[model samples]
Target chain A: MTAGTEMSGPRGTLPREVPSASQDSVPLLEAKGLNVWFGRHRRQALRDVSFRLAPGQRLGLIGQSGSGKSVTALAVMGLLPDTARTTGSIRFEGRELLGAPERALAALRGRDIAMVFQEPMTALDPTMRVGRQAAEAVRLHASATSRATRRRVIEAFAEVELPDPERVADAFPHELSGGQRQRVLLATALLNRPRLILCDEPTTALDVTVQAHVLDLLDRSLAASGAACLFISHDLAVVARVCQDIMVVFDGAIVETGPVARLLANPSHPYTRGLIAAARLDEAAPGSRLPTVEDFLRGTGS
Target chain B: MTAVFTVDHVSQVFQPRRSALAVVALDDVSLTVGKAERWGIVGESGSGKTTLLRLLAGLERPTSGAIAFEGAELTPAGRDSQRGFQDRGLRSRVQLVFQDPRSSLDPRMTVGAIVAEPLRGRRRRAGASSLSRPDRAARTAEVLAAVGLSADAARRYPHELSGGQRQRVAIARALAPNPDILLADEPVSALDVSVRAQILNLLTDLVAQMGLTLVLVSHDLGVVRHLCDRVAVLQHGRIVETGPTEQIYARPRQPYTQELLAAVPRLPAVLPPSDERKPPRPLQK
Candidate 1:
């Protein structure tokens, strides 16, 4: 894509023609006033969270750890822990998903909604061959023969640009480098051809160079498969690179929501402003004090 | 300027318990860190950045090549001594801050005890002339305050404090020795986005205030550029490129270094003019 060319805009100016989700289309996934409380004390985890994802659209959920971003994704998947209680509505393809049956959610998980987690090692089974794991993902969602499943797994690995797909498939997770392991996870996520991909800091554990490769692969794959993605990350630059829309969540709620270009051009929330200021370390003078979230919060008296 | 550390053609090799093949972690790597100068060692995982930091911290001796601390060769300690460096002076002069405070800081110990642990080593070496109990308490309080933690924080445990506060405690412990050099291994990599700036700012201030020679190892070039004047790029355990941070960032000599720089996702160079920006308001539920 010509997205790389758009980055050369005199540094401070927003990228030209930033993609925004089509508002007129029927929403693929929609959440309304989502609230989550955990355990016996009913401690609130999420508060009045609401957003919409159009078909084939990319939405970035920006927040730090424990900011309810991950919880929102888990809530959509109906994968929240048993002790947690959720209210409000989550609809996927015009079907209510919040209180869906376990069997029904299981069937929809890998077939329609696939998730890629931050840490590949923990997410993947250490004892299983990486190829077999990919095959298992395919086997669960589809009724393909064993040989066909193996071929599909190999094809998925090749599609994710893993070199020597056969060799990588046979190797254990411990043998592969961090980038290679993350690719295996990505290949597994894409093997089912899910319509929606939920990436929760998929490249957070990777090196910058490896992260670039993975993000590029994801961007290309999403474009090719016409799959929508909900990319969650604490890094605004990374989220901005892959996602068209930005949602800034603070504490348990979203503080701002807008197109990526608009958000970067003029952030309206103090927390969002602080995040942008902190992330622009390239522009910060050497040895100068960086503006923190507290500085922004205090300056605005919020 | 005097060199705080001189790593001469260092090479580190590790052999697994039963494996015939040996892994060369660092191959003929050499660098010099001047006193009070911040140097960043950038590399991917398994590129020997942490291994080099460990070598510099005197946690492990290199398989080959000599390391001189302040012009004095650091030799292995005697069997009777538990420290890595034979010289007591060198042992107390260099301190290390690890990546994750959750695992690095002992969960069993209170914040006060953890920060004061290094001082006890000094006390042991000083014998009768060591600091008194009250003096040690005062020193602990002072370091904690310097790291932006209150004195009351000393009474808490690692789990009781936030991730940022735990890191502050780790920095306070590293500073308790009043060392001339600070070796940080991905110090802020595990922190939240909002908290990273605070820690970086704190490190910058403390390094300047204490005149510390810092060796920061990280994969984040932006962080390295913000903190280090000079940078050494390590690839496959070798020094691929080394120069001023700005020089390397602007015109990298190696293709690998250029690719590494390009891969970093960058925010816009500057935000729009303030007049175009809107004042922020509190989000209503």
Candidate 2:
């Protein structure tokens, strides 16, 4: 139990660096009534999704596949495909992002905001060296000399606890292990000193032990930099472990949103309750049937 | 009390292309599974857990050492080729359910054909009992229902089903042959949180009803504890610890096992007050 509690805590407990400006006024990121439609069918992928993350605050989006968590992230980053029509208000640092010019959004991206994808291999260029990639991110915003960029890249690597930072900097994505590659990807994401990091199941592909370590790394980085995060994942435990606040997404809608401890302890929505019950592997007895979401949906008419 | 399967000093080495160094996937590992026992192998990536499972399924032979089934040595030579478990009788007796059914299940094949293909292989084997088309179809429907899939699922392709249902189809395929031992590698890891529990429960029920010896490999300790009677912690091609599930979780002897257990994410133990009152701030340093 001691070990378990050590991995979990509510928000504002860490030694977080105070935000530069007043965070009480404008949130770091905010989305309102986000509705997304894909292709000619214009089928609803996300509907009326809304949330807010204050500067230095970590917000988790929890949902299963096709729940529009990733789509939400893409919508925020202004990276959604052309065919996908979106109707929503996305504000980053009090600036309207939805329907904003791509050039304007691109200027904020990698400078004020960045994203870490689930699969690091595909996110990274296999042909490019890890350090060069990190350096490139740094160079995108700042007019740094090549030498200064390399030094900053190595510093970012060290920040993420990558061992033998020099050696890791020289290696390619394929040359590194999954954990190492993830760290490199994280380094790239954080290299530009972005105000917010949109992590879409970043640690899902990693092993449990490695996942813990990476989660720790992310916590420390977030605290040190005072950057906000929109952590997205399907695992309830993982989302609860990482973020202070949680939002449960289902069928392209936000079902529940609250402080992590409160929501997990007494989930109001049947879907949230079902998700919590499903993840309770420890409490489940041997040979007993595990309660499924379908059971809740049937009982409560989801 | 009889030993259902025994792995004797198994060691597997793979030589990477253009590299002189050999990757020791499994090194001098030995284990024995008694009848009706549900055993779990837990480890992180590169821990040889999957290699051990493959070896148990007879899908791959060790470069050195031997595996015995029902007290008889399973020779990797005459009856098998590169991918082991070629003996149809042995294949039927020790079936493997993979981590991802999307990749394992053939996309073009209907669910019925995928499940019945194993029995079809068994029929081709000399001295094996052959079943009629209708009997095979009935057996397929039976196993599908056992795994909680409807009879209509047989007519659909793998792509038509959800991830959890695809895994159920995979499980049905594994059970179609009536295997004495069921080896599942991270069966529920690929599934959503809501679907995972259902799948685990299904596996637990089926294993008990069929009286099948079970070998599960997963990185999640909680799932292992929920399903397995005994547990083994593997790291870098070695069994770091092995004991009963309760005892191991209650009092882990190995430091690695302790660390692995600690790494599993648990829900925070705080319950917020009913009102929307803010939590008291911690005292500043």
Candidate 3:
């Protein structure tokens, strides 16, 4: 239990940061009734999902493996493959996204929307120079020549706090540890000065110590840049730490959404409650049987 | 306390010859799995939780540590005793459920056959006739039912079952011979969260109903907290903290343990000032 209570006591009002009552602030991104369907059968992946993210508001997109959190992130970035069927409105800084031309979406991606996948080892080009890759991202979206792009790449490297940016620029993906590789990816994302950064399990592959550091960097990055973010993760604790508000997605829909503390403390939905109840550590007594496996996780409860 | 398995100052060091990089995976870690204790080994990735489990399962001999089973050293079993202790009778004593259920179960065999594999040795020991074809089928069906799957579901292949169902089949296979100890390594980490509780509950029930010693290895503190009685925190191949789950949670002495507990989502909302924050930042390898 927390030694000191937060701003909202018994009523559990969201800490002053939530901005639950205000909408005047220009949101960097908004998902309004976004719906996604896939396959020849048109299997629905998201149903009427909605959220508003102000500039620099770090939010968590949490759910089990199949919760559609990844799908949602892909859709927001306009990077979904040709096979995926998409519906719904996604506006970026008041710019309409749905039905936008491919060229327009392409221009916005590396510049306005950037993403870091779960596995940096797989996502990165094994043979490509780390600096060269970062430069390529800058060159693609920025109106700059190769020399200027190289300088921007080094600047981006410094922004992510990588040591010896020049040296890292020459190194390949395999030459760095898992956390360093992730930092490279973050640098790549930062190169475009993106407004909305989407991170999909950025630290899942790293050690706890490394995860903590990477997450701290991510947190500071959000604060420093005032960049709105959609952080997708299976680790709810990590999610709770970074995100002011959380959307509990299960299957293809949002099962619950509220301030992180309230949802974890007093979940209204059974699925949300089960996740919290099941998340308990040391609930089992010595020499006694534990509660029935919640099974909420076994099947599609969300 | 009578522990089914005991690790006495065990440590493993992997050295690449001609190089100074001697990777130490375990550091004289010692812990006792008291009989019937649902013990949890919790740590983040590379904290050596899985390596510790591998050591306890006797898959690899520790570089410098003594492991005793029923007061007998396990590292140096005689040839005949090694075969008997490791092969046929292991299911009746200890069994393991892997992290990925789909990959763990062989695709060629049906679920029923998978569950029956462990029963063969157990049947041979209890009575020669006990494992006849029909009897084998009956016992397989019984174990499947105990794990909450119908016998009819056993005829399906691994691909045919969902992730949760596949895990149940894996559990059924592990429990078929009724092992006194079950070591589940991230058994549900790969599954959906909604279904994680059900699998955890099933394991809890099995431990009580069968009087089994469960050594659960997982990075998810939530699952471990819900399932285990005693929790052990491991770091850099060392057992940093060991105590009753409540005591460990209520007051963690080690910095690693405290960091882990702080990372937990269920912790009451306590956003300390930046000065008080000791949360680990990512390390430089």
Best candidate (score: DockQ)? 2
lDDT for every model? 0.86, 0.85, 0.76
Residue-level lDDT of model 3, residues B1-285, one tens digit each, is 556888999888888798898989889989888888889999877678888888777777788877877666767633444554554455367789999897899999999999999877633444333467788899899999999998799788999888888999999998877678899999987765456666776787787889888899987665676678899988878787888877887788898888886654443443423333222221111
Q: lDDT per residue, candidate 1, A1-302, as tens digits?
A: 48776555334322223233643344778899999999999988899999988777788999877888999999999899999999999988767787767776887887789999999999999999999999988888678998999999999999999999999999999999999999999889888889899999999888788999999899888878878899999999888778777899988898899877789888898889888887887788878898888888788522
Q: How well is each residue in A63-92 modelled by candidate 3, as lDDT tens digits? A: 777779999898887777777777778878
Q: Tens digits of per-residue lDDT for model 2 on B83-185?
A: 3344446777788899988999999999999999988873343465787899899999999999998999999999999999999999999999888899999
DockQ of each: 0.36, 0.38, 0.16
lDDT of 3 at A136: 79
Give interface RMSD, every candidate, in order.
Answer: 7.9, 4.5, 7.8
Model 1: per-residue Cα lDDT over B1-285, one tens digit each = 558899999999999989999989999999999988899999888899999999897777888897778786664434322353633556667889998999999999999999999887653433334677898899999999999999999999999988889999999999997888999999998887788999999999999999999999999888899999999999989999999999998899999888888888887454433333111211111
Q: Is candidate 2 or candidate 3 better by DockQ?
A: 2
Off by over 4 Å in 1: A1-24, A300-302, B76-86, B122-129, B269-285
Between candidates 1 and 3, name the one with more favorable DockQ: 1
TM-score of chain B of 2: 0.90
lDDT of 2 at A125: 95
